[model samples]
Target: MEQKLLNSPQSEVNVIDSLFAEMVLDKALLDFRKKKIQQKIDQSLQDRNKREFLRLSEKLKDLS
Candidate 1:
């Protein structure tokens, strides 16, 4: 039975083949968007850190 099924050409045209390509494309787009958002968040955090550091440094200088 398995040999007979494998011998059929129509079996190759399954649901997986029809949807796999589209799914891969969608995944790539989603990954790109996620990376872009992550980069923006990282930049914002770095900016915040620099501002805090400078503020602290100024306060220390005033104390002296």
Candidate 2:
């Protein structure tokens, strides 16, 4: 049965592969977004924007 699915033109294997790739991309995007938020926090800290820094920190916590 597994072999049959793999051999079929419209295969479960292709669907699984596509879903896996999409999952990987989604994870990468989340990670990138977290990093960008961190950078903003760091900048806010340097520029002494206390309110903005706290807001970004809260966003970071939510992401994690």
Candidate 3:
């Protein structure tokens, strides 16, 4: 009976289906983490830009 099940086409299909599902989940999780890290980096850059702009504006005011 075990040999017969192994030879069956359905068993092969089920194995392939499970493997594809696992690959998809792994890719999705990786993408989510990548996006989250990018957002944090962008926020840091924005903050730095704002601080530099303010500093420059203060210098211009002092010169005037």
Cα-based RMSD of the predictions, in order?
A: 13.8, 4.7, 13.6
Task: Report how far off residue 15 is in candidate 2 (Å).
Answer: 1.2
Among the numbered candidates, top TM-score falls to: 2
Deviating ranges (above 4 Å) for candidate 2: 1-10
* Displacement of the residue 20 alpha carbon in candidate 1, Å: 0.6
Candidate lDDT (C-alpha), each: 0.64, 0.92, 0.69
What lDDT would candidate 3 get against the real structure?
0.69
In model 3, pairs of residues that clash are none
Question: Comparing 2 and 3 by lDDT, which wins?
Answer: 2
Please give the lDDT score at residue 6 for candidate 2.
61
Cα error, residue 55 of model 1, in Å, equals 24
- Pairs that collide, model 2: none
The true-structure Cα RMSD of candidate 2 reads 4.7
Q: In angstroms, give how far residue 58 of model 3 lies from its true place.
A: 34
Model 2 clash count equals: 0
Order of all candidates by lDDT, from best down to worst? 2, 3, 1
**Residue 5 in model 2: lDDT:** 52
